[model samples]
Target: MTFKLDPKMTLGYVQLRVQSLENQKAFYKLLGFTIIQESATEIIFGSGSTTPVLILTAEEDVVPRPSRTTGLFHFAILVPSREDLAHVIGNLLEIGAPISGAGDHLYSEAFYLSDSEGNGIEIYRDLPRNEWQVELDGQVNTATEPIDFQGIMALYNPERAWIGFPTGTILGHIHLNVTNLDDAISHFYLEAVGLDLMTNFMDSAFFMSAGGYHHHIAANIWQGVGAPLPPKIATGLMSFSLILSSTDELNKLKQNLLAQNVSFSEVEGDLFVKDLNNNDMIFYTQA
Candidate 1:
């Protein structure tokens, strides 16, 4: 693709329309997020910032995401260090939270879980860049191996109480389940959306990134080919923000979409676009 997003660009808030705001808030409270703001039917929360990174809204008629739908696979939360990761693992264990799985990816270690409403979540810490395995072509070498649960837990001082996600905790990336791999890649590629190809996993998934990071966005066909999108009022991902370092990067993205003949709408200072799966993407400058 002809366009490359600025390396400094990263993900911002992930908004979800849920069926029960009270239940979701109670669940996130266990994960260390402080309520930044709340209303009768919505809540915004983050680890240590006034700028919330997660938003949950309850709509009266919202339904659960239907089967075989193109929507969120997971949203990864990047912790600052391996030790911090261990702390989160420990917290979950202590609270009897259901852990979906865990893995060692060579470049990073991560574990997965689901929220009360079935939204997937990942908690992970990256290996130092110097330690990451990268090919001469700049594609990251990713591996799926069993993580050392014993070793990670060893780093945990059960002596310390669960506080929550650390100050540096941020929304690292978001993964989606699309209807078709080829069509999704066409919409998500470097030239199309300003990301460089980082890795293509086993022909089933594509990982793309900006600024040489492993991935800021990933999509897969693991659910099925030609999966249908959920209803507009489904309880899952509503939209997510991609935060550019400056307005210049946002403008460049606008130009890239125009070149592709893709339709996008700008509201206030933010640009809104939809992917092949009908997932909403908000492109904007950093807060």
Candidate 2:
């Protein structure tokens, strides 16, 4: 009953609809993401590689998503080291950015912030892989506790001016707000798109990952039970990419979707499927 994914599976670029291009550029630039591609209507940003990690598309007169909506909860950026994480917090402090929350999640230490359009963001570094504790039921134990801010800051070198995201940074995970956990679990995650269950908290939230990492995806009804989908014109998540290691693996998932009778669209060489909540998950293989 192991619900694992291909070892090479990874999260890729996240596309978002933003109210102001300049605002997003300024925010992401300060965080060390460089513009890799740009157009009149869209801009692609990368952490330290040419591959796009975050994409922003222009949305005119976009409405802000309501709190009680089923959509993006947050997109997490995982840096290579604790020192890199400190650099993120340091830069935020220097820019006077408003942080919504900062916590030590047992397995990782993270700081939460939001883009100008209110899309949630988490910048974090994981603890050593060996230190993760798993329970009898095979769920990783994660707790929300205060981060050692002082300790993290002490690692920051004042000699080095704060710059943007480092080379090894990656789009670590995407967490979503869903109306029904059961539907999300069975209809979308397990049956159609395969992802290993990592943890579950009460009946409210659960975490899933591909290759033994804490979580590559998470869903929660934290907004409200049976929350409605945000309007299309709302400034929020558009879609996110899941990079599979090989075309064969991608085909297996495509077959799984077909068997479940899930509607999907194929573009070029990739496939894209929508979850029960209508959130788009794009599957593509790298060369």
TM-score for predicted model 2 compared with the true structure = 0.95
Q: Write the per-residue lDDT of candidate 1 for residues 1-287, one digit (tens) a residue.
A: 46778789878889988998888999888777889999998899897567778999888889999978889999999999988999988988888988989999998899999998889999999999999899999899898899999999999988776678877899999999988877546665656787887988898888888988999898888889888888989989988888899998889888888997788999998999987767688989866
> Over the stretch 1-287, how does candidate 2's per-residue lDDT look in tens digits?
43345768999999998888888888888767899989878999998788899999997778888779988999999999999888878877878887889999989999999888789999999999888888877789888999999999998876676557877999999999988887646667865677777888777888988877789989999998888998888888889999999988888888777777878999998898886557678899987
lDDT for each candidate structure: 0.87, 0.85
Off by over 4 Å in 1: none
Number of the top-ranking candidate, with lDDT as the measure: 1
Return the lDDT, model 2, position 201. Answer: 73
Worst 10 residues of 1 by lDDT: 183-192
User: How well does candidate 1 score on lDDT at residue 209?
Assistant: 87
In model 2, the Cα lDDT at residue 180 comes to 80
TM-score to native of every candidate shown: 0.96, 0.95
Error of 1 at 91 (Å): 1.4
